[model samples]
Target: MPFTVQYAVPMTCEDCTKSIKKALDNVEGVENVDFDLEKKLVTIRGESAPSQIVSAMRGIGRDAIVRGSGRPNSAAVCILENAQGKTRGLVRFIEDEEHQIIIDCTVAPTTPQAQQVSIHASGDMSQGAMSTGEKLYTLGMTSKFGDVFSLITRQSLPLMNTIGRSVVVGPPSGPTTESLAGVIARSAGLWENDKVVCSCTGMTLWEERKVATTV
Candidate 1:
């Protein structure tokens, strides 16, 4: 899985340029390299570790660092299905870095109530129903067909871990009997929720936005 990364480096001569070029070329996962003299920027397209790229530049005695990234270089998606017509969801995994992945999730809300959605070990919803496989991550959806929720996992794991897996949307089994209690339960620290999820992500819920979109 390769993505693009740009870097800033200080080079005064051809020797400096060549040295930096050669250094980055030798990196284990770097696929291609192009240097812009005017911008002093280097764009690399590969699976090279960001740290490794910076280290390579430093090895040439040139102080270099990353420039800009607008999106993930690599990605994967899951097609979520629900039988009760409660909601449908789509979860995307965006590249955070070489070692980590960011979750970009969208769901179509059918029921006004919040549902517990997540990435599971398998996509088969028929066997034991929605809760069939091991629940990998708990997801939150406030509005159905609109805004996307962003969650960052600390694992820095590869997307290969999700290739054949499925995303499930269902009711949350919570300790407290309340609306969206499953979500609150997750925040309260139950199940395997904290291991993969690092923190609370900025996302929109129906209640917050209904004020603006309401008739």
Candidate 2:
């Protein structure tokens, strides 16, 4: 099923928009692309993975941050972290109208050997990934490029049931003592998050983005 995703891309001129549009045009699964130059936003209606869309924009020397995706109550996110509390990467789940879930994930500092990713029954983190309960679903294996590992796939998992569960990434054989894990949480849907500044932190979106990138 086709869904909508919004991205904040800085644009300084009409040429920038043209370049972005042209680049996205070549991206498979993209159905439509709309731009808001004044707000520096691009709303894409398609089935393309968000990572792929961002890569396309980067191909043209532009950077894009996902603002929102999917419909209300159809999106979720997880921030993967090691037991030491350092963020390793992020995973996003967007469910389409037909209930198919799109799993988009990126992690780093992984070995060349493929890693197995799965969802656990527990969200407990007192002992890190070890505390999570039995694995409920194996999402898939991730391919490593350099030190980073990325995976984009679709699954039939029910998004609502997965919230508060834990996602673990470990050796292909299964999760080990060194596996990374994170609790799944709800995320903003398309046009659902439009705040320029976070009221809790008083930081602008770009400022928050900078901090996120560094971590």
Candidate 3:
């Protein structure tokens, strides 16, 4: 999905900005990157997934949050840890009674040690919807279908969203042009007249409805 990355990089001079651009520009899947020292922001327009961005930033000892006018799925709990088994931070995706997605990020001393992690968990409850508790169970119980931890996070670590009849169309599997259109539509909440102004990478067709409305 389209996202803006803001980080506290020490870009106090033009040379620093150029250096950042050089590093970020070389990252695979990154399209364009702009750094603003005054705002302490590094805004990036790209299809690169969050994990890729995070990995790149962390490699250079930088931190970033990707948000923007067009975001597709909500990323699930991110457990950043050190070799000492310390949990550096946790970001959770929760849904309330209203079916709206709530995202919470927390800093902790250590990452929770678990048998596994399932990124494809939901927090919202609705008709035919699953609960976060259920997701937790799946993460802990389901091991045959695939490795939940890797499967859910292999892409961009996704958190389950709504679970009702989708207003938009979706493909059976894999990524397609139609799939991208669907995600763009949902994220923007485009109606009959609304159209997708742009498309972002790492977004699924299911998210088109949300983006359509919110953007």
Leading candidate by lDDT:
2
Q: What lDDT is reached at residue 109 by model 3?
A: 16
Total clashes for model 1: 4
- In model 1, what lDDT does residue 187 have? 14
**TM accuracy, model 2:** 0.80
TM-score of each: 0.39, 0.80, 0.40
Scored by TM-score, the top model is: 2
Worst window of 10 by summed lDDT in candidate 3:
181-190
Candidate 1 structure quality by residue, lDDT tens digits, 63-114: 5534433343345554444443223444445454454554444444445665
Candidate 3, residue 212: Cα displacement in angstroms equals 33
Candidate 2 lDDT over 1-215, as tens digits, reads 68777777878789999999999989999999998887778988888877689778878877575666657888788988887887877787877656777777677654556688899999998888889889999988887533367676767898999999999998756666778899999987667775656799997655654443243
Candidate 1 vs candidate 3: the lDDT winner is 1
Number of clashing pairs per prediction, in order:
4, 0, 21
Give the lDDT of residue 24 in candidate 1: 78
